[model samples]
Target chain A: MNTLQLDLGERSYPIHIGANLLAQPDLYKKHLKGSLTAVVTNETVAPLYADRVVKTLESLGQKVKLIVLPDGEVFKTWEVLQKIFDGLLECSADRKATLVALGGGVIGDMTGFAAACYMRGIRFIQVPTTLLSQVDSSVGGKTGINHPLGKNMVGAFYQPQAVIADLDTLKTLPPKELAAGLAEVIKHGAIADAEFLTWIENNQNALNACDPKAMEHAVRRSCEIKSQVVAQDEKEGGLRAILNFGHTFGHAIEAGMGYGQWLHGEAVGCGMVLAADLSVRVGLLSEADASRLKKITAALRLPTVPPKLGINRYMELMSVDKKAEGGEVRYILLDGFGRAKIQAVDDALVIQTLQAAGAG
Target chain B: MNTLQLDLGERSYPIHIGANLLAQPDLYKKHLKGSLTAVVTNETVAPLYADRVVKTLESLGQKVKLIVLPDGEVFKTWEVLQKIFDGLLECSADRKATLVALGGGVIGDMTGFAAACYMRGIRFIQVPTTLLSQVDSSVGGKTGINHPLGKNMVGAFYQPQAVIADLDTLKTLPPKELAAGLAEVIKHGAIADAEFLTWIENNQNALNACDPKAMEHAVRRSCEIKSQVVAQDEKEGGLRAILNFGHTFGHAIEAGMGYGQWLHGEAVGCGMVLAADLSVRVGLLSEADASRLKKITAALRLPTVPPKLGINRYMELMSVDKKAEGGEVRYILLDGFGRAKIQAVDDALVIQTLQAAGAG
Candidate 1:
């Protein structure tokens, strides 16, 4: 077992990476505050892990309530959120109760948001099952539902008490989702750690094969990078914006292609390519390093070309991206291979990048 | 003008109590972060004050967008919140843009919650028009929408940059709503300030008449007491529960009678009577003090008798109160005339108090 801590003062919590972690009591039980615990999972994940999770909590004498939401990014809506509320209220779960999110990013985001809003706020644990979630979303306290007009448009920065990433669950994950998760791992390296990027390049075959040792290293390093960034800029005042390196363009792809059409990681994987292209055009990054980043994403079997949504459609969607200010979209471009900076690109330059990076 | 600051470290903000505050650009404009601002008001308040608010911000070179929601407590829902998001997205308002909630408690709460969730978080200002909001909701960072299953079941504790409470807006407030606002004032006095309680008792007629001087004193004093309590316990971990002296029972009243059927203040007024009765039964308060509290609420023309929601219904509703833990309903009752404590009363004892205080 390997552990990494996200130091957030009073809000600090640990992320545990290991196989069969859910079967281990100490990882989750240490964070449990009250006797009442609600396990919020989606339908797909519920059939697989809900029983083990409930059994573990019940063994610790917790009165457990299971709230199973429908699966998918589309289910991440206000109506589904209300269902979580309904379960909490129906079971009379109070402010003292703990909510355990027992699925991937969707469940983690929804449950973290549910905890933030449930009775103003409550304690919750993140048990991220997907690689994407374990590496990124679950670490930073960014939990919210997507607005129809945009992705992750509604949410809160409510941190969890702890994060339990049981690698055993990854065994059941579809290959496509696993590869999608690597997009974020690649992002962490691209934005902050050049050494980690080289390490990823060396271990690409090991990662593609889903070797436990390689997976553990990728997850831990990614979380360490994220935790350091979040500890400094908890609410994205300035430094935290760097973490959204590919997200602005990624969000446009997610919204433009219709949410759920492309997995978040896939969109982000392609978005990073465009951001790199824009970086080279703006003279912020070298053409060699930009292509290296693109080559690595392609090697991971992630999308290297963005879908050709009309430049105007993409512009309309990106205009509503949270990173935009006063209607001008701010792009997070690489200063080099491992450093990121937020800059406003010229409209003409962005259009050129769009034209150059689009799939035929 | 009277000002009180709720000291929450960096999240601290000032509460300005005066007449014609909206016309003063320095009060709000100084806190404005970006050139774009969205003024969120309800229908009832829009025709009355939206133009002045927009003009005030416009005077300071802010490009403003006005979003008018239907006026009423019932309109505080996710669907209406979508309207606020729609307006911001439609105009492409970004993270730096400001959201100014320009109505009573409902508008303040909905807009504050929207600002808290929009793009994960953004800067917002409170321009409270109703006396209820001026004294209570606007000062604290508590903002949310009511769920069908529970009131304030979904929300966040996102503080505003500043709160501008213009007493001048109360001149147009309906008589019934003004009295409802007084209920909170009376509560502040009863729970924390015996002297303020005595003052409310002596000045009932002036308060009932909506005298500007009396209104200013009541609003300022209430905010002072609330700000002090919130500064110590911002998230209600302990001492702050005392602030909800009548809210446990009050939430039941609001949920028992369909929301908006009984104005929040009216229900809280009557709930205080029931809570006082329970406190007397528990031997924490004197019968004489309890009756005195009831007499003042009655004197203000607020309800002294709670509607006859069956004991079972009240118990069912109160069990879901945020104060409750592990299915035990915790009531905030007066320990004497001005002190409060949270304790779990026996269900039978609560039933007895309900039978004694209900309208016959």
Candidate 2:
């Protein structure tokens, strides 16, 4: 098993990466706090792994409660987040109980947020079952539900006790979901690690085929970059804003497409392409580098062409994004091959990039 | 103007206590961040002081927006919390925008929780109008909405940039509300300040008459005791539990009687009496001291007798309280004149106390 630790002072936690790591009771036992544990998962992933987790916890004499929510990005709302609370309250889950988020990004985000607010905060563990969550959401303490006005507009930056990413769970991921996960993997490389970007470009076929070694490498590299960024700036005051490279435009895309229609990763994939296009138009990134970024996105079967959501609609949606400030949407654009920075671009130029990226 | 600072390390903020504090543009400007500010108040407070706050901000050259929610504790739900987000989104409030929570405890809590979760947290200032909020909720960083199952069950420990407690607003407060605020004032004395308890007893007539000098002293002292306790234990790990001296039973009363049926302070007033009875029964507190506490509560015109919600029902509701652990309801009982601690008492003793307190 490969392990990476996010050194966030008192909030520091570990990420365990390996196949069949879920069956390891020691990993689950070492991190959890208090007496009782609530494993929060979604319907799609619950039937697959919830029982296994419950059995493991119960076998260890840990009082375990389960809350299975409906799957899909659409379910990531305050109403759905309430279900986790209701379940915990019904089961008499106390201050000492730890919540184990046991699904993909949506589950991790919602469960992590629930932990953050439960009794003004409780211990939670991340059992991210998808590559998207394992590399991205699982590492950062950012957890929240989507608002109707924008995606992830309401949430908290609450860390987990630990993160366990069992590669075996990837076996059940559909091809579309796998490709969606690649969007975030591609983002980690595009924003900070050029060598990792090249590795992803070189191992496109293996990654697309879900090769174990390639997947492990990709997840590890992505987590290392995210953990470093988060450790330096946990609250996203400065440097952490760069991690949201494709998120500003991606959130617009997700909101415009009416959430769940376009996967978060898919929106981010297209968003990275548009941000790259904006970077090139603004003369920040070279056309060759921009094309290379788009090339990798396309190679992984992720959407490079953004849906033709009207430019006005896109601008309207993007303006409400978390990244937007004082009526200006700040775009995270690549300054060089592997470096990115937050910049507020001219509206006309942003519109031009939106038009061009949509037409691509 | 009287000022008490809550020294919570980096999260520390100042609580300004005085008459006409809302008119002070500098106090509002000094603490608020960003270019735009959204002032969140309620329908009741809107006509009273919302315009004055807006005028103050506008005169300071700060672009201001307003969102007026329905008043009362019943309105402190996820549905109402969403309206603040809707208003912020409609006006394009960003991460840089400051949310000025301008109302009572309900408004302070919901608005603070909104600011805490808005864009994964943002800067917020508390403009507390009610006595309960000005002395308690406004100072502490406890912000959140309520679930149907519980009060403050869903929330965050996000502190505000500053708190402005304008005593002039109390002029318009109903007599019942003023008495309710004394419950918390009484709690502060019971838990941490013996001299303050005597002061409250001596100044009951002045407090009931809403004497300005007496009110200021009460508010200031309550905040000082609370600030000291919170500074030592922000997350209620140990010392902070004493701050919730009457809250465990108070929350149960509030939940059992139906939210907003009786004021939070009213429930707590009776809850303190019940806790005292339990302390006496457990031999931790003398009957004379318990009766003295009850007499003070009675003299203040606050409820000393609790409604007879079935013992089983009370236990069920109290078990879900944030203070409860492993299905054991930990009661915060006063051990002596000015000391309180969390103790999980025998079920039979708890039931006996409930029966006697309800009968009283």
Candidate 3:
């Protein structure tokens, strides 16, 4: 087991990395301080893990209630949030009832959001099931549902009481999803740590083989980088924009294709490739570095190009991305591997990058 | 003008309390740094103040867009919050657009929530008109809306860029609404400063007659007390709950009677009376002190006895209050005016207190 703590003063929370950590009942017991613990999961996760978690919570003298929601990002909406509230009321959970989010990014995001809204705010634990959630979404406490017009359009920067990412759960995730999760792991390297990028490139086979130590290192390093970024810019005031390295274009792709059509990390993976290519065009990144980024991502089986959505539709969709500054579309282009900067690029350049990235 | 600062480091904002502050275009122009500003108001405040504030923002080379929403507390829903997003989208409001909340608490809460959710967050200014908003709601930055099952079920503790509380607007307020707002003003005295309570008691007639100095002192002292409390406990971890001295009972009244049936301040006025009566039952307050609270609230023409809701309905409603911890319905009991403490009394004692308050 490996442990990393995000030092955010009172907002600080610990991230635990290890195999079978979920089976450690103490992790569940420690974070949930209330008498009642509500488990929020999607249809997929509940059948597999909810009972075990509930039994653990019950053994700790806590009453457990389960709210099993529909799976997928498309279900992330105000109506779904309302359902969670209904469950809370029906179960008679109070302000002290701890909400435990138990699934990957979709479930984690929706549950974190549900906890954020439930009773104005309540204690919640993130028990991420997917690799993407374990590496990225589960740790930082940014929770929200998507508005019809935009992705993550309505949410709060609410930190969870604790995060427990059990690597054992990843064994159950599909290969495609695992590849998607690795995209974020690679993102952490490209944006802030060239050494980590090299390490990922060297250990891609081991990571694909589910080597425990290698996987834990990837998760811990990604969390450490994100923790530092989040601590400095908890509310996305400035430095936090770097965390959206591929998200500006990624969100546009996701929204353009409609949510649930592509995995978040997969879209982000393609967006990063295009972003790197654009950086090369703009002279901030070397073609060699861009090639290195692609070779490593390919080893993980993640997509390196956006699906064929026409450039005009893509541009219009991305224009509303929260990452855009002052109505101008921007990208978190790399200055080189391990260094990134936000740049306002012209439409012509973005269209050109799209053409190159989408070219066969 | 009286200025009180919240002192929350970078989140700190000044509460400007005085007559004609909002009418001055310079006040709006000085704080708004960018050219794009969106004034989010409701139907009630649009015809009343939006045009005037828009003219001021426009005069300062700002492109102003008015998002006029439907009025009422019940309208403070996610649906309405989405409308603000829609309006921003319609206006093509980029990150540079500053949201100016130009109305009472509902508008401020909704606008702040929208800003907090818009692109993760945007700069917002609170132009609080009602005394309830000016003295308490505007300063705290606890922005959210009610749920069908619970009040303020979803929200965030988002601070504003600035707060402009113009006292002159109170002149046109309906007598009932104005008196209701004074409930919060009186509450600050009861929870934080005995001297302020005495001052309010001594200047009852002058305050009723709209003495500018009395209003100034009332607003400043109230803001200062709240500022100190909020500084210590940004979230309701501890001291901030003292600010809810009357809120537990007030929330029950609002929920029991259905939201908007009784104005928020009116319910809080009654809640304060019930809470004071509860204090006597719990052995923290003397009967004499309790009577004085009723007298003071009555002097301000605020409701003293909580409205008749059957004991069962009150219990059902109060149990769901965000303050209820571990199924224990705790009330903020007052030892006397300007001194309050949270206490868990037996259900029997709560019933007796309500009966006594209703009779008194």
Candidate 4:
């Protein structure tokens, strides 16, 4: 078992990664504030791991309630987020009642946000059941629902009590979902660690096969890089903008196609490719480095090309992104491997890159 | 103008209380991050002060968009709150865009919560027009919308950049609303300042007539006491709970009668009366002091009696309150004048108090 602590002062929490940690009841006992606990998951994960978690909480004498929301990124909206509130209120969950998020990024985001808002605020644990969530969403305290205008447009930077990433759950993940998770894993490597990117390129087969050892390193390294950046800038004031390297373009893809059309990591994967192209145009990166990043993304089975959302549509979508300041979309470009920069480029340059990528 | 600072470390902000402060552009300029600013008000306040605020922002070279929501507490729901988001999105408000809450408590809350959640968070200024908002809601960082299940069931504790409490706006306030605002002014005196309570008791005429000097002192002192308590415990971990002196019972009455039926301060006024009765029953206060508090509440023309909701219904309502822990309702009882205590009392005693008040 490997544990990493995300240092956020009083809001800091531990991230537990290992095999079958969900079956270990002790990981949850310390975080439970009261007798009542609500395990919030989606329909898909509920059928698989809900009972194991419920029995574990109940063994410790907790009155556990299972709230199963519909699964998918499309369900990440205020209307659907209200269901979690409804379930909690129906059971009379109080300020001290703990919520355990037991699914992927969508579930973790919604439950964490629900915890942030329920009675002003409450405690919640992130029990991520997917690779994308374990590596990205679980570590950061960013919890929120998306609006029709943009992805993750409404939410809070609320930290969790702890994040339990049970590797055993990844054994059942579909190949496509595994690829989506790899996108973020690649992002961590591309922006912060050059050697890690090389390692990913060399270990494509091991990752695709979901080898326990390789998966563990991937998740750990990804969390380490992401947590360090988050620790420095908890609220995305300045330094944290680097963490949104491909998000400006990624969010456009997600919103332009309507959420759920492309998995978040998938859109982010292709968005990275577009961002690298923009990096080359802006004289920040060599074409060879951009090509290398693209090759690595494609080798992992994630999409390397964005959908044909058109120049105007993509620009419109990106302008509403949270990273945009004063209506000017700021692009997070790769200055070089292991380094990133955020700046606003000319719209003409952005359009040229989009046209080259066939997205214009 | 009288300026008081709420010391919340990095999140600290100034509360400016005086006549015609809203028309002063300098107050808004220092806080605004960018050119775009959204003025969020309700229908009632828009016709009264929206133009003045917008003109002020426009004069400072701000591109202002006015978002008018429906008036009343009933509209303090997520559904109605969405309108603010819609307005912001329609205008392409970016991360640096500022939101000015230009009404009473409802506008301040929804706008503050909107600012808290919009793109994770944004900047907002509170221009409280109502006396109740000027004295209470604008000072604290508590921002949220209500649910069918409870008042403020979902929201965030987001601080505003500044709170502009214009005494001039109170001139247009209705007599009942003025009395409602007095409830909180009276509460600050009862729970934290016995001298202020005595002053309130002696100056009912000036307060009733909305005299500038009396109103200024009332709002300034309330902000001082509330900000001090908030500075010690911003998230209500312990010391801040005392600030909710009558909120537990008050929320029950508001929810029991359906929101918007009784103005929040009116319900709080009556709830304070019930809490005083409970304090007497628990041997925490003398019957004479309790009667004195009730007399002061009634003298301000605020309701001193709770509606007959029956003991069971009141219990049900209070249990779901944010103060409740693990299904047990924690009552904020008066320790004596100018002090408060939180504890779980026997259900039988609560029932007896309710019966005695003719609310059973």
The DockQ values of the predictions, listed in order, are 0.83, 0.82, 0.58, 0.86
Could you give the candidate ranking by DockQ, starting with the highest? Answer: 4, 1, 2, 3
Chain A only: TM-score of every candidate? Answer: 0.98, 0.98, 0.97, 0.99
The sequence of per-residue lDDT tens digits that candidate 2 reaches over residues B243-344 is 888887888889988999999999899889989999999999999999999999988889887777888888888888888877777889888979897889
For candidate 3, give the lDDT of residue A16: 86
Across A136-237, the per-residue lDDT of candidate 2 in tens digits comes to 888888999988777888999999999999998988889888998999999999999899999999999999999999999989998999999999999988
The root-mean-square deviation over C-alpha atoms between each candidate and the true structure, in angstroms, is 1.5, 1.5, 2.4, 1.2
Candidate 2 Cα lDDT to native? 0.89
* Chain B TM-score, candidates in order: 0.98, 0.98, 0.96, 0.99
Any runs in candidate 1 off by more than 4 Å, and if so which?
none
lDDT of 1 at A6: 87
Candidate 1, clashing residue pairs? Answer: none
- Least accurate stretch of 10 residues (summed lDDT) in model 3 chain A? A351-360
For model 3, the superposed segments whose C-alpha errors exceed 4 Å read A202-206, A209-214, B211-213, B357-360
Tell how far residue A19 is off in model 1, in angstroms.
1.1
What is candidate 1's lDDT per residue for B164-203, written digit by digit as tens?
Answer: 9999999999988998899999899988999999999999
Tell how far residue B323 is off in model 4, in angstroms. 1.3
lDDT (C-alpha) at residue A178 in model 2: 93
Q: Which 10 consecutive residues of model 1 chain B have the lowest summed lDDT?
A: B351-360
How accurate locally, in lDDT, is each candidate? Answer: 0.90, 0.89, 0.84, 0.92
* Docking quality (DockQ) of candidate 4: 0.86
What's the distance in Å from true for residue A40, model 4?
0.7
Tell me how far the alpha carbon of residue B81 in candidate 4 is from the true structure, in angstroms, after superposition: 0.6
For all predictions in the order shown, the interface RMSD in Å is: 1.1, 1.2, 1.8, 1.0
Fnat per model, in the order shown: 0.94, 0.91, 0.71, 0.95
Clashing residue pairs in candidate 3, if any? B190-B338
